[model samples]
Target: MLQYFTLPVTAFQQNCSLVWCDETLLAAVIDPGGDLPAILAQAERRQLKLEQIWLTHAHIDHAGGAGELARTRALPIVGPHPGDQFWIDGLPQQSAMFGFPPAEAFTPTRWLDDGDTVQIGNETLSVRHCPGHTPGHVVFHAPQIERAFVGDVLFAGSIGRTDFPQGNHQQLIDSITQRLWPMGDGTVFIPGHGPESSFGRERKSNPYVGGT
Candidate 1:
């Protein structure tokens, strides 16, 4: 079975996820936002080697620690299709714009495609390009654990904001309907911030998104 830990980091408190499997001992770090210490602490506690750092989008709060963490762990850093490459590449500028400490530029080792799979333990994480929160936001769906580490694209009772650069309101709505809601109602969505909720709950209650 897959085991998981949540590390809520950065000023905005993005929930970075550390998911691993007992048998294979393989692990993947999702959105290592900030506070490298906590992410490392969980890595040490679980003794699961981080194979890769996967990003759902390019927002600084959800990607701040990615460069440092990957360098520290010697893990490959992968992002969502590079549509947010500008944001990812301009992290320092983004930090400055958001009134934070200057950070170094981060270039991911790999740019994940829509149908790509990043194996973790025995299962495969299905990548679905669900932009709108940012132009490259995506969600990693792991059926074995019935969990999805969605970035700003999803939340408990609300959806992600579409006011930033490359953010599109209509596109975000379409992504939710076409890419996410179709994942079935049972999928447990672990968003960038706040408590976890299922696709069913969000479909039923999210004000910004309407259910079919």
Candidate 2:
């Protein structure tokens, strides 16, 4: 079975998830935005053998800590699609802009695309290329558990803002309606920020992208 714990990090309070395959104890940290020491400490306390660092997008709050953690743990960094390269490249500026600590730009060890599958011990998570929040944003779905780590794409009561450079409102909507919704309404999702919610609940009541 796959198990996870969400750690809210940085001034943005981004949700950084520590996911593991309980059988093997192999773990992957998702959206490691900041507070590297705390994240490492928690993993240590839990006795998790951290293996990979995964990013949902390149926003400073979601990807700021990735480079440092990868360097410290010698783990591979993956995902957020190829389109978010610009955002990743601009990490330093984003950090300065948002009053975060200095951030370093990095290239993913492997770039993911829609339909790609990543493995965490015995569990496999499907990737969905969900743009709008950021062109390269992608959601990680654990089908067996009916759960998703949906970056800033879809939230409990609102959708990701399309006001940033390269953002497109319609694309965000399509990603949610056409890609995310079909995953099954009962699916529970972990957003980049705020509390987690079910796709069913969001689809029925989310003010931004809810209802038939």
Candidate 3:
């Protein structure tokens, strides 16, 4: 079975998830923004062997610590699609702008696309290329666990802000309706900066995309 723990990191309170397969104890950190010490401590407490760094997008708050973590731990970084290459490249600028610790840009070992799959020990998660939040934003869906790690795409009552560079409001709306809606109403999603919410509940009450 796949198990996960969410830890809010950085001043932005980005949700960095530590996911692992209970059977193999092999773990992956999703969106490791800042606060490396805390993330490492949690993984140590769980006795999980960190193997991979998975990214949803390359925003500073979501990927600030990824490069450092991967370099130090010898872990491979993955996902966020190829479109976010520029964002990854701009890590230094973003860090300065956001008043975060100096961030390093990194090259992903694998750039995921829609319909791709990532493995954590024995568990498999499907990847959905959900843009709008960032051109290369993605969502990791674990059907077996009925959970989706959705970056700044959707929240309990709001959606991602499409005012950043290359951000398109229409594209974001389309991504939510087309890419997320099919995940089933019962699917629980972990957003980038807020509490988790179910698709069913969001659909019924989220003003941004509700009643659609």
Estimate TM-scores for all models: 0.95, 0.98, 0.99
Clashing pairs in 2: none
Error of 3 at 210 (Å): 0.4
Winner on TM-score (1 vs 3):
3
Instruction: For candidate 3, write residues 1-20 as lDDT tens digits.
Output: 99999999999999999999
Candidate 2: tens digits of C-alpha lDDT, residues 77-139:
998799999999999999999999999899899999999999999999999999988899999
Model 3 C-alpha RMSD vs. true structure (Å) is: 0.5
Best by TM-score: 3
Runs of candidate 1 with Cα error greater than 4 angstroms are none
Q: What is the lDDT of residue 157 in candidate 1?
A: 85
Any idea what lDDT model 1 has?
0.84
lDDT of 1 by residue, 22-85 (tens): 8888888898878888888889888887888899987888887788877777888888778998
Backbone clash numbers for all candidates listed: 0, 0, 0
lDDT of 3 at 5: 99
Which portions of model 3 miss their true places by more than 4 Å?
A: none
Q: Clash number for model 2?
A: 0
Give candidate 2 regions above 4 Å deviation. none
lDDT of each: 0.84, 0.93, 0.95
